[model samples]
Target: MPESLNRELLEVSAQVRGLLQDLQNLGFDEVPLAPPTAGLPRCGTAGRADGGEPGVSCRPESLEEIRADLENSPCCDLCRERGNLVFGVGDPHARLVLIGEAPGREEDETGEPFVGEAGRLLDRILSAMGLSREEVYLCNVLKCRPPGNRDPRPEEVAACRPFLERQLAAIAPEVIVTLGKCAAQALLQETTAVGELRGHWHEYRSIPVMPTYHPAYLLRNPASKREVWEDMKGVMKRLRGGGSR
Candidate 1:
């Protein structure tokens, strides 16, 4: 057996394990496996044991579907004060997904995440990385903005999590860059500050999640821009298949 093949197998196994962990964390304890053909060769976890509930083959959902649901279904009270749901915008098949905390005043008015001052800074950051907003998908932990740009409450985060999960599953980006403490904590389930979470590689359902300072923070503390750049560098390296922390 070739060493390269062995390494590939190990990597696949690790990804599978991470996926399982994330599913369990999301409260999906029993994942139904695919049913095996009687005389056909299958690969990976393609087949479930013959018996119980029939396996339902699931397919990736589209952003439009998720957005429509969110628009029609009021997840939390944030809707009453919101002008729009601000369901994500950008490339649906993008390899990179940038997640943020929640909508601000400008975002609430614009019906788009990251369209205000912080959004412009985010654009600059992407430019420095030799990318554009169109090149990567963008969204938030909470789709609707809280009143007065306040931090999202726990119940709000809980109510909106399912939508976020669907977006992630639909995009299935190779790397996830979460901007700020709210986005980071919501996804990674960490109570630590963004200062500590940044500059390291974390996993969210099998995808690499890089938590960094929010652009709003950068506006207040320009010095932290350096740290955010360092995190972006790591993200670029990972995207290039030259893995880094």
Candidate 2:
């Protein structure tokens, strides 16, 4: 064989080996050497790969659909006593999702997340980032408010986890801003303090997450606002396509 032809064959073999390794790492035991090409849409085309009609989306159920399914969910005791479910609010297609621990008295009464004192501070923070509440999706780790505004019990969080996960999947935001220890820990599945977690980048289901102090915490410790602002700047930077600082 010609030397040039041998070198080309070797490069192709290496590329195929790398592809096989990646498939194995992803839990695939076997891959068809010649997969079916029928019904597969070309890249950037409108046709569906599964032979579905053009312009039809195979994406998962939307947030509104999920919310409707969980509208009357009685999964926890908090749901029984709660005045409202407080599912979430804001643009369903938002690029940024702001998550907090749980709802407060004001939120529970109003059936909205982040509408109380902390919400006002959050408004200021959003303003600093040149954003509005309507521009970003907002929700809590737990849907229902804990009695007396206490931390969510483990069982409560466990019960409501599916709803949160569904929400994340439905929105599929580009960036997630966890606004306190509870929100951060819940999403990251870690027990790190907010001080340690903040000013750093974390991931949840492949989405970038920025953990920052809750607005309520800043209300008590005003000095921490600067730190939170720094964190928000990082979030803004990421949103603008500049990688995290």
Best by TM-score: 1
Clash count, one per candidate: 0, 0
- 68-156 in candidate 1: lDDT tens per residue? 87888888899777987788889999999999999988888889999998899999999999999999999999999898888899999
Q: What lDDT score goes with residue 99 in model 2?
A: 92
Model 2 ranges off by over 4 Å: 1-58
Model 2 agreement with the true structure over 1-245: per-residue lDDT tens digits: 99999999999999999999999999999987865554544311122423446674454556776677677558888888888889999999999999999889999999999998899989988998999999999999888889899999888888887788778877779999999998898888888999999999999878999999999999999999899989999999999999967
Runs of candidate 1 with Cα error greater than 4 angstroms are: 1-54
lDDT of each: 0.87, 0.86
Steric clash pairs (candidate 2) = none
Scored against the true structure, residue 171 in model 2 reaches a CA lDDT of 79
Best by lDDT: 1
Model 2: worst 10 consecutive residues (lDDT sum): 41-50
Question: Per-candidate TM vs. native?
Answer: 0.78, 0.76
